[model samples]
Target chain A: MLKFTCPYCGIEASETELAAGGEAHLKRYGPGSSEQDFEGYLFLRKNPKGVHLERWRHVMGCGKWFLAARHTATLEVFGTYSAQTHEPPAEIIENIRAKFPEWQA
Target chain B: MSDPRSAVGGAVYEGYVTVKDSGAHGMITLRGDHAELAEAVKAAVGSGMPTQRRIEGGLGGGAAWASPDELLLFCDYADAAGALEKARKSLEGNHFLVADVSDARAVFALEGSGIRDLLAKLCPADLSPEALPHGEFRRSHLGQVAAAFWLESEETATVICFRSVAPYVYDLLSEAVKGGPIGIF
Candidate 1:
């Protein structure tokens, strides 16, 4: 059983509490403006089998929206942070920074 | 001390237990101004205000910070006086509400590889490692009463339900341990 640390509720839940909502941070092709964009949305996935920042829901329990960074192959989850949380868990951000050194707004 | 926590499945296997208390410890409530109270508490105890994980070691005692403004502290059993005095001396007259919770609830710690599986059978909340990593806790219905699971490790968790429901939870786990199958994870 895999677990994700919910930053808000502060409980580690089994994968059962969470719902994978599709590729996290998914970018639409021109804001739902074209059919090709819709098709791309429906059929495309980088599926990079690496650490990914994706949307998760505490569906069966907390019923909250959160972001989770996970290692797909091993399912080594670092943590989960609320979507509304701006400060973001420092440890996770650091890991992200290490992976994508140039990551910036 | 094994954390004064009763492990269900009775040490039958490595981490499984046969029977155990649902809530093993007492939880106290404190209401005060966060800034002044927290600082004074820190000075008095050595460390207070649990910021991470379950069971925060206090400046003068111990507690589990259940929420941002809520904490569960105790001064009963092994170090009752020490814990109580520590809390009293530090913020006694500084406008705080302290109460004894020795019998308000009971607690239990569920350990071993089969924890996720057994809890899944008893609890509706997700106990999967991917969904809940660790250092997680929540209060919800365990069968009929309000129970909580404090994730201590990937394989171990502390369960807390009311004293009234203690027997039921204990029976539930005991049956799960003996009558149920094992969780491979």
Candidate 2:
């Protein structure tokens, strides 16, 4: 089972204690946006083989949500950050870039 | 008002490990800034917040850390209302949430030779003394139900789970010891 560290509680929780929230940092297309933009926002998702960012809630533990960066193929987790932030922190971006130089955060 | 009955009473198993009902206790889920809430909590519950993941005992009862900003205060069910009122008074202007969830959970105590290994079967959290130690609280699961557990001493532990599923958890634990030190619960 995958292990995750909760940014709010500082506990390293097993995957069972956490709930995956699929994809992070999605821009909302509401009200004035084009239909295609709204459709993309609602239905489109990136399923990259390497270096992906996602959201997770510590459901059985602290009940706080957080973000995690991981590789879909290798299962190597880069790091976890607080859910309160609007963007990924610079150090995390740097770590991902170091591993996949062509990738952008 | 009616008194709450114990979810699972009497000893269900007589083996190397024993399980007993701890009865219903007054429980509060308090959340706020730890440093700020510590004083108010001490005034209200007769004990201060435990240092991250620990449990502290005092004249009134015991306080267990549920998370970084949360503390679970447990006392006699009869005294819970009064304790919550006192804590609210002490916490006056702070940004906090104090919820009395006394009936939400049923508590049980497990003690014996292989209780740690038995707990390891059900919970993913490390139960080794060096890692968990005494007085440390961990929130995890007992099968599919959510549970919070802590070590009272070397051979003893207290487990709290949702009231509705207390019997199911007890039965699962009972089945674990029937086969003489099974690998999984």
- The numbered model that scores best in DockQ is 2
Report the lDDT tens digits of candidate 2 across residue range B54-91.
88982138788887778899878988888888778888
Error of 1 at B130 (Å): 3.9
Q: Give all candidates' CA lDDT scores.
A: 0.60, 0.82
Per-residue lDDT tens digits for candidate 2, residues A35-86, read 9999999999998988899999998987888999989888788889988788
TM-scores of the candidates are: 0.51, 0.92
Residue pairs of candidate 2 with colliding backbone atoms: none
Each prediction's DockQ against the real complex: 0.07, 0.68
The DockQ-based CAPRI class assigned to model 2 is medium
lDDT of 2 at B18: 81
